[model samples]
Target: MPRAWWRQLLSRFDPTPIPDPLWRRALVSCPLARRLDDERQHALRGLSAAFLARKRFHPLAGAVLDERIRLLIAMQACLPALEQGVRCLRGWRELLVYPGEFKVRRSHHDEHSGVVSEAEDVLIGEAWERGPLILSLADVQLDLEQPWDGYNVVVHEMAHKFDMLDGPPDGVPPLPDGINRRDWIVAFQRAYDHLSNDVARGRETLIDPYAAESADEFFAVVSEMHWSQPGLMQRAEPSVAALLTAYYGPSPAPT
Candidate 1:
């Protein structure tokens, strides 16, 4: 290859590395990521750097997004991509942060009734297909302090992003080579049905009842459990838990 070709390739692919101090500080703040083994942690640093380079951050509503906090968010966002590698982070380019909960005005249409209703939804995090990743700064900080709480706004929204990769969020993201798509769909559908039944009967449940909302929401909620409380998920749905572990790699949550 010509020397000019090498420079262009480098500019396109090689992102600026995170400085050692920034990496250490960000890692220290993110307990979920701090639990990764040294090799994976190093890999995460590179991924985080790439994420920061490729994604634009829009801090709105007085969201205090400093360099350290930005780096912290990048590290957590990239944690789920460690095993999948950087390819999984493609097709998106924005991260929007709010100081706290944000409200979105949404329109809902009923197919059978031909009725449309508009409502405002208060959200901590949300992801749209081929759009920006939105998050709550307060929730992100809370997850950092209570790392094992089985709730992470960033991870939950990121799961939706992953699910939307191949197409719409149908609870199944693009699978890796070893993971069978049929098996994944079967396991997740079974678990979603079980949870839906329990919620319908008004029974106590292990996984969040919000997961019963839809297939994609179930996937996102379980993904939060996978990173923060895999044991809880294992107890609720063994097969789904197993598949999630296989897809995202082992949970860093304390055993």
Candidate 2:
């Protein structure tokens, strides 16, 4: 049988459905998931079930992991993939949760000098290309408590996953039918440059200055706004906002 068929057959035996009580509890805690329309909410439920079925979750550093918490995480993680379908979640299998912030060491190689410099960076969440999705459980809970704060660790990392689906993240994910690749590149490029300029001038910006770091970060940061503070995104970068709206479907976030 084909790979797709084999996966489908396996899914038939995966016991991943969230019970009604657990689902209701999770929805009550997650404003973003609660705000989704009925149609999309239904899709999210199925996609989340699939996520739980396919991915392995490991709680580290004595982080408390429970069914409710897992369901909550799955719900938010699947939001970005709602329109794209569960297939968008392909190419990853592990979800690592830490109690709080984690530190990761990085080695930067200077291309001209060929000097390797090392540094440690703290992260709330991280998504690796074709690897595990790492997150801080505390940060995930914080996002639930402050859903409209214009930041969402799960969404941000999931955006990176989407961006990396085709290759290394360059701010562009695989476009769906009816979305012009050239148009996406032009609009994203202009928006990214504008934000980069503002950050360089030390001006406060509506979109996160972190987004100005690179095209991929820009896409991921704007994606958080697309779901959390879409009005701000629209005002900051109408073209990019429109593109995100088209790609992610209408914002369930309240204006």
Candidate 3:
């Protein structure tokens, strides 16, 4: 089927609506919800419901569970997916939530000797391209009450999903038919180079320096900037902002 036809079909589907109690609980627990008004809150609830209905949630570590906790996780995870539209996250299935920070092991190999070395680190959430999403419930709870404007673990992980959409997480996704893929490459490259130079020169970067580490990180950091500091993102890299807007639509005016 053509992209236009898929979109048209999806348009006919109504966004799932969350129950009133759940929406109220989400507003109480998640500080991010404070930014939204009544109507927007309902809209968010609807989007979140659609996401929960589409994706599976797997709770690990803690056997104890409640509706509010799960809804909290769903709301945050769904925000980015909702912003991009329901079909954006269609490929993924389950969300495996751990009780706290979980250890992820990484192995290094000496290319010449072909010997392997291993290391581990704790993480909040990770998205696998063709696999399930891993999340830390404890970290998610911390995020619920915290007031950090742009530091959303859910959005960060979902950004990786966007990066992975085209193939590997290489800082870009498939553009609409008329948009030039070459132009996207140029724009992202220019922004990436600029960020790298700023880090090298010890200049203040609007986003974290970790963004300079890789194209994937660049995409994720830029995504955070899009929602957290849109004005700054627009000024520093208009093309990035344009790309985000093209995908997510214009953000609602600050209320």
Candidate 4:
């Protein structure tokens, strides 16, 4: 009889299948989804429908969002959750979309100097713990246009969301049983250290240097590569790539 009980009961049921025309149209626009084998593609469609049913979307700063674009966003946002399942999508309920890059003001505190500074950041996508998922519509479309470019704003931000599930983003999400947590930590730490060293020395590296920003960002960045350019990721860091494949299942990126 309680709201929580009702919500739990409702979560057990799958949302209605996405309308045929909309699903086909969105699928045509997104090569990553198009490339998925039939079975997984079937799962993705239902998961995406669940996403559209559960999450609320808000268009801000002159951004335009129709049902078609919303379905497109939902499809990509739910891609990372296919292996993880629909439960992982539960914590967040709102999505804020911007026309392009949106700016957020931040305050940085110096650890030893006791000084605080304020700055602004231009971001294309971001995810918050138990909060809203934000994105730039233009960049989302760009990712659809350039599917194999090793970057996917939706996947990158969704990775952050998954990482935040257990706690703050730590480059590690809660693993299902039988997957050794220690192995994940060791493999990711070694790869993160190597990338950080390369970045510090100003060496060009295969994995994005932006990953060196932090372990959590490393996970998110590699997640983007996992979905968009797993081949390149395998070439750059085979161990990490193997772990990712094991965790996220095989990449659907084009050969």
Candidate 5:
């Protein structure tokens, strides 16, 4: 039978609503969702439903269509943008999920001679400008099954979406009124500098060394740690905690 024209048109704009039972079961099964209370779980479920309904989950070549995989991806993608607003994910719709870590070629200039060199990266997730958000199912599934500290690829990529909202993926986002942008600049700058110095000296640091690369990376790294290790960031760097809280509200404290 030929497809109905109205259905096709409607489906373009309307998202698929997930069933309550399926959603609830997903929360119980995933370790990452374990930290959330009932209320938070409910909110997350709603957000995921809306997200999955609106966005396109395009499995990479040889990928399977599994309920668990889609649920896991949806929940993670929505969590970071939950507080900010659903509009944060607007415009982008496609998601490419790979079976495992994929190779990406990144080209950069050599400082001295401005020679462009290409390097391969085993990436877990990568978001492109006006393109699909790609993820490694293997890596993310393991993370979901066994929760880790301050390293969430889902949140990390979503943070990029937020950072890219205003302009290019710069470290800064349009903060709310209460947060002083200047103060935020000073706080993040000092913190990034400190972390960069520690990484250079080969010393242990709470946040990842990748943060030192750029302001955008710093925001993404700190956003992951801010949610994963909220208490630590709060106690150790009050300014960072305050800034995050202003942007995303109080998140679940790390156990």
Candidate 6:
């Protein structure tokens, strides 16, 4: 059998249940999860449990991770997967957590000149195509404390994971049966171009300026807005907001 099939089989057999007390504690820490309706809350609980079962968590840089912290992380991580179902989380199984912001050295080769340049970037969160999801534990805690501030490290990284599901991060994930793929591409492209142009001209933009970096970043940034500040997202880009609502179900954040 294929590796994915094997993993699915293992997941089916090992259904680790998140205890009631633990679940309640996690909900207290996670406003977004707490706001979910009874039905969605139940779904989130199951997804969180599955996430704990299938993924490995590593605490680095003196980060202290307890069971409750892990559960809290799982709860937030599973939120994006709620609408897409657990299958959207396929192809990855590790989460690396640092105590705070971390620096990563990256080398980029210029295609034109064939010269390689190396740089170190400080990041709160990052998701690789087929590698671990990395995060700063401090940022994660801050998001839990302030859930409506238009920033969520977990959700932003999760969006990239979903974007990479169909291949590379191209601002689009695998669509369901009824969602029009061409329409998604067109709407997102127009929105991305508009943001890019605004940023190029140094004009004020409602969406994050970082989103103007690329199409994939635009998708991830908008996704953060959808979950953390739905009202702002809708006001800034109603079309993109509507598409995200359709893709990820209704936002659990307060209006």
TM-score of each: 0.94, 0.94, 0.81, 0.94, 0.86, 0.94
Off by over 4 Å in 4: 1-11
lDDT of 4 by residue, 160-238 (tens): 9999999999999988675689999999999999999999999999999999999999999999999999989999889
Candidates' lDDT values, in order?
0.89, 0.90, 0.72, 0.88, 0.76, 0.90
Residue 143 error, candidate 1, Å: 0.6
Write down the TM-score for model 4: 0.94
As a TM-score, model 2 comes out at 0.94
- Among residues 3 or more apart in sequence or in different chains, the pairs in candidate 2 whose N, CA or C atoms overlap within 3 Å are none
Q: How much is 196 displaced in model 3, in angstroms?
A: 2.2
Segments of candidate 1 deviating more than 4 angstroms? 1-12
lDDT of each residue in 23-98, candidate 2, tens digit only: 8989999999898877777778877888999899999999999999998899889899876776688999999999
Q: Compared with the true structure, what per-residue lDDT tens digits does model 6 show for residues 92-164?
A: 9999999999999999999999999999999999999999999999999999999999999999999999999
Residue 106 CA displacement from its true place in model 6, Å? 0.8
TM-score of 5: 0.86
C-alpha positional error of residue 134 in candidate 1 after TM-score superposition, expressed in Å: 0.5
Better of 3 and 4 by lDDT: 4
Error of 2 at 238 (Å): 1.0
Among all windows of ten consecutive residues in candidate 1, which has the lowest summed lDDT? 1-10
Query: Looking at model 5, which ten-residue stretch has the lowest summed lDDT?
Result: 1-10
Residue-by-residue lDDT tens digits, candidate 1, 1-255: 223423443567899888988888887889988898877787777778788899999999899899999988888887778678777888889999999999999999999999999999999999999999999999999999999989999989989999999999999999988999999999999999999999999999999999999999999999999999999999999999999999888988985
Tell me the tens digit of each residue's lDDT in model 5 across 75-137.
888777656556677757888989888999989999999899999998889887667888888
